[model samples]
Target: MASTEFDFIIVGGGLSGLVLATRLTEDPDIKVLVIEAGNDLTSDPRVNVPAMWPQLQGTTSDWSFKTVPQKGMGGRMLEVPQGRMLGGSAALNGLNFVVSSKDNIDAWGADLGNGPGWNWEGLSKAFRKAYSLTTSGNIEKEGPVQVTIPEEDTKWPQVWRETFAGLEYDPTGNDDPFSGKNLGAVMRTRSFAGNAYFAQARSRSNLTLWTTTVVEKLVLEPSSTRVTATGVQYTKDSSETKTVNAGREVILTAGTFGSPKLLELSGIGEADLLKSLNIEPVIDNPHVGENLQNHPVCVLSFETDPANEEGFETLDKLTRQDPATLAAAMDAYSQKQRGPLSKTNCNAMAHVPLPGISTEEGKADLARLLNSTSTAAEKGKTPSAFAKKHEAFVHSILTNPRKASDGPDGRFAPPPSVSGDSGGHFTIGVMLSHPLSRGSCHLANTRGELAIDPNHLGHSLDVEILARHVQFLESVLVKSEPLASHIKTKRCAPRPEMGISDANEAKRFVRETAIGASHYTGTCSMMPRELGGVVDPALRVYGCGNLRVCDASIIPLMPRGNPMATVYGVAERAAEIIIAGL
Candidate 1:
């Protein structure tokens, strides 16, 4: 292998990695190299078009990981698709832009001891510094990356505005901290220019982005005490093996799954797990692959009569409605980056406190569940209480007519059931913002292939919380005046097949079907090494000087919303840290 060195070696060219590399390279004196395992997607049409994302699944651009048989999922393996392109998962993601709660930032400071610098104010500044807002009035450009609202004004946007207004919620600025009330129209923010995906802003003069380069392992010094990172050994075009070096530092931005697996292969995980793989141990840290977390989501899809588009139609509607209309719309979008392809399909999202559930309550409940004395009974009690309270709050919120109003164009209808079939649709998805259950990533064999065992639905508390979320949705459909007309009370599988009607049944349903939102985090966590953390608060892997990790993997906990903004912010902040240290 030819040996070439640089000031910094960043593995993974995803959003986070690119941000770090681009920001660092702004100082022309420093050399930065970014190695990506996937191909360059600068002009990939599927990635550029907003609505074409769903079609990206099962494609080569996705890592397409399958979780090990989940005990909580009736021993079923679930498909977990992660982006493997230059922009990383962001290139293939749904392109939702939402920031975390202020409380979430405070919790991170309190839990990880990263100081107030990592708080909301600090993170917000970083967010502004990383993204360039394209919207006019109040929302000004803040960073290098451009952001804009979708051009296609679909019915979903109006629906979201009306629904939030009915709920007495107000649409505030994009960075406003979320409280239980005042839920409003979710402003659409994405990496788009006019109608196409935006990737040009991140391409910098000094940043060297290497595509289709998979990092094999982190080479260490003989002492194993001082890790030079040396260079990354990788497979190019999936045919040849080569090694490239970092003259000063190696930053692991290979994302959650890829980062931890690289660490393990380099003998930096739990001593026992490494021994199992017949690799010599460099560090006996048990937490390297531990504490894996993700946001689990359950989708709701409805069959709406086509006033907007017509893919599915009854014989009667087909005879009456214009079939050529939708085809023409699709064709138009494909050619000009306008029309339906510009729409994200999801216009808005609501964040509720679920009644008596507050940030403090969740923290305490999580601690007790994680370290409870009574296993079965205590597990049953806390979550049950939490669920009941949450469901009650949801019921009250939805049933109240004030909570069902939307902006103009019927954006918000009473939770589907109440809206009846006015050519409308509803989907009540419950997402666990922060989960207590954690899993790990390690080497399955020595051949370099990785294994990700998230152990999703492993925690009884997670099941309890998710179950309550579902029950709350059900209560809204049944009790809310606005939602009653649209309520299709057909209980689906796992819940109905098992004949589960009570709290237990709801919990079982959550356990069996809750899927990851693909927000995988905390594998190579950042904290003081004494607390079982791999990287320090500065994101440098402890005991390994000149080595750092700049990605979501370093985030100790999953925030309360989409992580894209946060990931970009972290990378921006990290570049400053690395530069200052230099």
Candidate 2:
């Protein structure tokens, strides 16, 4: 029997793991250990600064993995960036703190019958627990994360709210976005932990964290018919390998990409892949590496007229192109939390369905392209591994309870000014709220890094939906008042010159412009065994005792907006689930 160093051994010290460690250690008696691969970046400017999020990609803070050339996406490869630091992507991401609607949460829980605890009412409590509700009546203020809701009088958000209200695209319906309906333009909250979520928890003497350490695999001991996970195998430097036992459970909170890779290495995936990798099969669970989903986004930017330059232009200067400007902004932020650094990459948001959202002809055409057999032809390839399941997912997203009328088919957010940009910027983007595409992350060898393929826009249906949004936003929607008057030049991606009506042209355009929203989920989905789920609704990994996953990886589906708030809530609920078992 291995010596148990802690009651729970958490694999990653990322967002979810930190939340779990804090929750579990509140009892001071329970021992927990968090093993993190990246160095503790608590106060690293690359992490704490919201504007520097774009700068961190492909840098030390990012995993910097690239997708296998996406055949569906004009044979172009995408830069799949995952945070390698302490808070994981949460620390490296654009600080847009937002949550899903009640209807959206129900789709993942009650509607799918996941569990009572997974539903809206159940998770809403976790939402409040994770962040103290601010004056916006949306987020929490006193929690580990400091959430700043943009004042109603703020310039960009004010303009966006008025523009959206006049258009009647979708009324916000309620003041608090967390109350459920978030349809109109509203200023969003941004999370600033002040390097705290884990730092503050250091006072809890029962917790231990290993930084700059890599988790090799899980320590599974088999007994006759079943396998029990006792602990984890990890190493600080390749020269030394150590095993830390977990008396209660071994939780894998290693994000969407890291968790599934850990499971595969531990011999809990498809038999063929394991055999090929020379790893012994312990569970032969095919679902362990399947069901990967992420939101696909595209930005359509326009050059704002210099004469019409308002507060939006000041945003461009704050990107810190000059040393003096950067120093000045930092000085201002220290004095008062109100500065350009306080703003998010996106200032305001809206959700809308295209003009043809309900048309029969549109649906039929999409169906033809998304059909399991024909989809490969669109990509100029043979059949894909997940063709049929993704085909079904495509139809479901379009026909689910959250369709054009109630839940938006796509989301729109005001764009941030880019550094070194020639002119003022105004962008309208299309968000594939529920993407049909699937991808996987698995190890090719015993190496620390894992091979990943997000399968971006692999489904032809996504291209069709996003193309429609682009056409509508530019030709039909943006051509409307206050918004149209501000645009001076046609400096945009999927340029206005491209004929969007032509299907081939639209497909080519979508392929060229699409980018990942970094909201990766469903890799280690919590669903029923029959549906090829890796984890149960209780968050326990199937076919294993004392092994579980608590992170974005367990998110069975992608929610509407930024996943930070949702991920935080999931961690909060995971604490409840783990406590019940204890």
Candidate 3:
């Protein structure tokens, strides 16, 4: 029963936890303690190498969990990997840094009735506050993080740019709210400093980050209805149980899975479920482990001849960029903190609308169809019948862009139609950013450890949306002349049944082989108490006084792009709220 105290006790040492801890400790008078359930980043090479992310997929640095059998995915379980290191998932994810859609943020604010601050204007400030931009290729700050865009000597950047241009999307300023359409340039928001990972930015002077410490419970004060999270009980390296006391608060930043499990283990979840586990309910918050949402992503890989890989070959070489070349780039960055490497990888993203959209309505008619179970019913027919109907539908959607009726900034114009007959081979990676299906995260046992049940592809519509995306890829393969030349064969899971050119067959193929984007969120949602909200507008749990959740779990809906930047932005804002409250 040894006890240690701090002015602020932050759980989990990932991006959110670290950001809050770092900000809190900035004031020398305050003490911040960060307890992590994973290893430190100082010696982890997998975290440092920008090109090694795919290899780290299921490693020890990842909390490699799987979902329950998805009914829409032909009853198959899918891998869900979360970062288990000090930097959290940011340490092991595709380094595509793009701000989420402003529409998504507005929806979140509307849902919470929080007004403008929760909208884009408020979030934009937070994004700038946390990150010091150095685009145009430079590393101005000697901070612990370094972001560089992938080198442009490669063909990938050019091809990506052309594709977006072909779609008629504005290529610059996609990351900035004030910037116009046509956002180009890959965001260089990675933590790479030279050839190594930058761990210092997340590391702080007063923040004591204790890795390999798995929190098992939150000890609350006995008398007050307000949750005085006095301390936490955790297992050290999964071998020993230990308790550490917090003089003031216990903030849970253990991510979607770990955070909710902590709440449940502390008896703060659904009463019936806790009662089933023979644990008495403390807070009776049914939403503690509900509302799980993640991006469902499907990649279409193209195998091209090494000789045809001329332009793209630059990417391979860039991965092996020599010290001299890197040094020169570094010098350029040092001078101005702006260079090619300082930009983001994705240049543009299009929000295509389905048919029957109105320019002034702002309502997403296509999203409705994508979210409709009827689409699934249409796609779920036997393979032969589906392919017959799917092909034409796919072609129409790809060549004709749908504009969101009633977009916040007025309706975006329809994308330029690619020559329906043009040819070239390219893979279309379809990602569903905002999914409606919800799941849950609970403790595996009485001891507090996360049992992540993502329920991936839980709803029929999720599968339908992915199916539509796949159809779009197929259309590109068959319709475009240049794209068609590069395509040797269609490669992916549940390989299309031989000679099964029907729409039904394609639908079946998509249903059987779809995968996830690994962006799990919303297990501990921030909403009003009436809507099964786990935390309030300030991210504090409804019944708990001093405890707060400042990670992706607080996001009520999945954003329309990569979530890392948003996660960082949210953490920054949460830090401000926490500080203001104190």
Question: Which candidate wins on TM-score?
Answer: 2
lDDT of 3 by residue, 80-100 (tens): 888888778887776655566
TM-scores of all predicted structures: 0.80, 0.87, 0.78
What TM-score, to 2 decimals, does candidate 3 have? 0.78
For model 2 the local lDDT of residue 159 reads 56
Can you give the lDDT of residue 168 in candidate 2?
A: 66
* Per-residue C-alpha lDDT of model 1 across residues 176-231, encoded as one tens digit per residue: 22222222221322362212212433455556767877888888774734655687
Window of ten residues with lowest summed lDDT in model 2: 405-414
Pick the winner on TM-score between candidates 2 and 3: 2
- Give me the runs in candidate 3 sitting further than 4 Å from their true place: 137-146, 167-189, 192-205, 238-240, 305-309, 312-352, 355-427, 447-451, 477-503
Give Cα distance to truth, residue 354, candidate 3, Å: 3.9
Clashing pairs in 2: 131-140, 132-139, 132-140, 132-141, 133-139, 133-140, 134-139
- Which wins on TM-score, candidate 1 or candidate 2? 2
Root-mean-square deviation per candidate: 7.1, 4.3, 8.7
Error of 3 at 173 (Å): 7.4
Q: Give the lowest summed-lDDT range of ten residues in model 3.
A: 406-415
Better of 2 and 3 by lDDT: 2
Q: Assess each prediction's global lDDT (C-alpha) against the native.
A: 0.62, 0.69, 0.60
